[model samples]
Target chain A: MIEVAGVTKRYGERAAVDGIGFSVSQGEILGFLGPNGAGKTTTMRILTGYVPPTSGTARVAGFDVQEHPIEAKRRIGYLPEHPPLYTDMLVRPFLRFVATIRGVPGKDINARVDRAIERCGLAPVAGRLIGNLSKGFQQRVGLAQAILHEPDVLILDEPTVGLDPSQIRDIRQLIKSFAGAHTVILSTHILAEVTMTCNRVLIINEGRIAADETLEQLAARGGKTRRIALRLARPGDGVEGAIRAIPGVLSVIREGGQDGAFVVETEGTRDAREAIAQAAVTHGWGLLEMRPITLSLEDIFICIIQGEEAA
Target chain B: MRNVLAIAWREVRTYFTSPLAYVVVGVFLMLSGWMFWASLVRFSSLCLQYGNNPYVFNQLNVNDMVVRPMFGSMAVIFLLLIPVVTMRLLAEERRTGTAELLFTCPITSGQVILGKYLGAAFLLAVMLGVTLSYPLLIMATSAKPDVGPTLVGYLGVLLLGLSFIAVGLLISAMTENQIVAAVGAFGALLMLWAIGWVADSATDTVAYRLNQVTFGLWDKLHLGLGGPTVGDLLNKLSVSEHLGDFRKGLLDTEHVVFYLSVVFFSLFMTQRIVESRRWRG
Candidate 1:
């Protein structure tokens, strides 16, 4: 429901978003991962029609953002990094106002506003002034406004930034509930937010997209070159050499600072556990434990970022 | 149009919900009330002096002596109050980051400008409405309040306030700081109001040309031109200058068009400035 093609936003001599392209299909929740100053917010601003991209085009629900701003914007529900709320307004009135301006039918305005308030868990604070609400509740108010009109696409920037763990979990649950009915592009620097809520991940770094893959695909890629940690009860001579001798075993080295422990780097998806076990028996090295180290998303992110820096 | 009204209604509600509306309105009414009382006292003193003198009494028109001076004083008060009313229209939105919500909405820049301008204008209307009690008091106590001129004078006040709020709203859109917006609007309005002072020092032809285009309401009192001339052109250009004619109960369409045109032009420029932010961002 959202398409960004070769978008580059330049401010004078600096490019905030350089040659970035991505798309989110209907009902797909795509997590936008990037560190600070990674052009994630800039890309969201362009998608929402708040800023015009210097080059290239952004479309929401098949409408060009710059060329047909109103039409495109009508289909988008945007929650900026700051939430863009009027602090002086009460929660209910504010949502009603948002609904009105977003072209919600007058007859259904109350229903829509009430639904949003309930969905964002803002019913208790509905009568309170927004400025007086806690940051987490205020963030809910922001999300409530974005979803008030039930737009086809949602572009949220750091929606869960300042929340406590429970609030973060609540917001993540709320975002995850939008799957398959609303196409959402959630931008955040938090690694777990993506893992918990996103179907696919697009990692942007230094004004460019560093990596884009499904969660499973990225995990599979990380598993392509595997590492294993092993421990032995007996100290046996030539154990490392014997383990290294196994086919598909790339290297076997003793782990420093840990006695009777070794790390094995293997090529491909081969299960070297059997070979290592056999080697331990043949060398009379008492086997203690052996497990393949699974790479987390954080590791994958760091690896991609570090790989980019190295390149 | 519905979107414009929605935005306008929300802004109006905000004005009242915050301390800004009450504070500005309260201060404005106090100043207007004081000015009214002062003008009434000065008129009563004049009445006493001319009570027995037929010639002077005939010259001492109550509308001329009391109502006209009150309107003039009220205009000066508006010069101060209007900037305060409009300072937060766009500037506060930008400051608090709500402008992003507005821009990302389906509404156009023109609609936002219209909504903000109308919202501030409505506040000015309420302020002017409260001052009506002063004129009603005169109507009740005096034998004749010269209802025609008094009504037109009220109309003149509203137009002048409308024009001033438009300029103030435009100034508000230029910056995000409320104090800066308020002070900047005051400076712009002062420049517009004080421009007529310079017209007096120039030679007759130059003075007429300068006052015609400069911002001063006093020039219309001196208007004797029967046809379009340099002086006529300059008189048309001054916002306050047209109020002088309305004070005499003239109700000229020319003055009405001038006020409306100034309002339209200012709002147009404000919309342009707002639309440019998206491009410049």
Candidate 2:
């Protein structure tokens, strides 16, 4: 539901967000991964209509951000990097105010705010001043405001920055719950967050889109080899030799375990479990556990960044 | 209009809830009260000198001797207090990053600037409103208190307050620092207030040209001039010049338009500044 075309934002001689373009389909959770100063926040700001891009355009729900700002903004729910909260305002009242400005019907404001508060788990501190709340609670308040109106598009910048582990999980779950309902584009420096919550990842570096693909595609393209961890119960010195002798097996290293635990690195994505299983049975090696090691987003991210640097 | 009211509502609530509001209102009332009491004491002692004598009645009317000067002094007080009331309008939002919320909302730049201006103007009106009891008491106790000029003077101060608020809002939008906003607004207003002084001292050759742009409440209408001259033109520029007519119970459309134009012009500049921020950001 969001389309960005050659969007660029410049401040004097510095280009905060250079010409970068991407689109998120309806109900898709697109994770924006980038290092600090990668112009992620600037891109979010331009999409939200908080800042005008120096070149090109961003459209939300088919409305160009600059030409039809009110219409475009009406369909967007933005949670800025710092939350953009009225610190002195009570949590509930602030949400109500946001609801009003977001074009919620006068009669439905309370119901909407309550729903947002509930979704963000901000009920207990709803009556308290925002400035008095802790950082994690404040981040919840920020999330609450972004989803307050249930906008069609939610653009969040570092939404889970200051939360505890549990709070972060809760936010991640909440974001995941928006699947098939709201198109979400969240930017963060955290690589693991994208792996856990995002269906697709867009890796940005130096104001450019270095990589963009589905999570699975990214992992497959991570490298040429597929690594698998195998744990055999029987003690056999020849087990490692047998596994490495199988075709497509590149290398075998003993990964410390009870015994006979070997990490078999293969040259391709083919499954070598059938070959290894037959050999294990023949040799009377008790086959215990075997699983393919998928590439984490961290590994994929580092690889992409390192490859970009090398290029 | 609802968007304007929503923004205004938040700003007004913030002003009333914050310590800054209480401190500004408290300090304003205390100072105005003191000025009121001093004016009353001066008028009363002067009354004693007259001793029920109708001869000196023409020399000392309550409106001129007490209310008029009190309002003139209140106008100056407003010059100082308006900045304090308006300094945080846009500066605090920018500093706290709430401008992102506002800019991203469905509201336009014009709405934000107007809402903030109106909120600060309303607070200034309340501040001026509280001090009205001084004139009300004079009307109740004094049989011959001139109500026309007193009410007109209040109107004049309101207009003056509106002008200050507009200017303050513009300066507030120019920076993210509240202190700098306050001081810059105050300094700009002080220069406008002091420009008339320059004209008065140099009323010889260059004064006529300088007088047109200077703002002061004490400037006369200069109606006797057959046509507009440099001096009359300068008199027209004085923001305070129009208030002088009001203190004398003269409601000139020209003065009304001048004050409104300043408010409109300042708010327009403020809107431009807010718009530029979005671009620069």
Q: lDDT (0-100) at residue B20 of candidate 2? A: 77
- Candidate 2 lDDT over B117-205, as tens digits, reads 87887788788889888888877775356777777888888898899899899999999999999999999888767555455444444
Give the per-residue lDDT digits (tens) of candidate 1, residues A1-311. 88899999999899999999988899999999988999999999999999999999998999999999999999999999998888888999999999988889899999999899889988899999999999999999999999988999999999999889999999999998988889999999999889889989999988999988998987776666678899998856777778888989888778863478888989866888888888888787788989988877787888887663210
Query: Candidate 2 overall Cα lDDT vs. reference?
Result: 0.85
Q: Give the true-contact fraction for every prediction, in order.
A: 0.87, 0.88
- TM-score of every model versus the real structure: 0.92, 0.87
- Quick one: how many clashes does candidate 2 have? 7
When summed lDDT is taken over every stretch of 10 residues in candidate 1 chain B, the lowest stretch is: B224-233
lDDT of 2 by residue, A110-225 (tens): 99998998888998999999999999899989989989888999998988997889989988999999888999998999988988889999989888898989988887674577
- Model 1, runs deviating above 4 Å: A232-240, A257-260, A284-286, A308-311, B204-237
Cand. 1 TM to true fold = 0.92
Candidate 1, residues B149-265: lDDT per residue as tens digits?
899999998999999999999999999898999999999888777655544443356445546666543366665323344444455567678788888778988888888888999
Q: How far off is residue A11 in model 1, in Å?
A: 1.2
| Each model's lDDT | 0.87, 0.85
Error of 2 at A289 (Å): 14
Task: Tell me the spans in candidate 2 whose CA falls farther than 4 Å from its real position.
Answer: A226-266, A269-294, A308-311, B200-235
Question: Could you give the DockQ of candidate 1?
Answer: 0.70
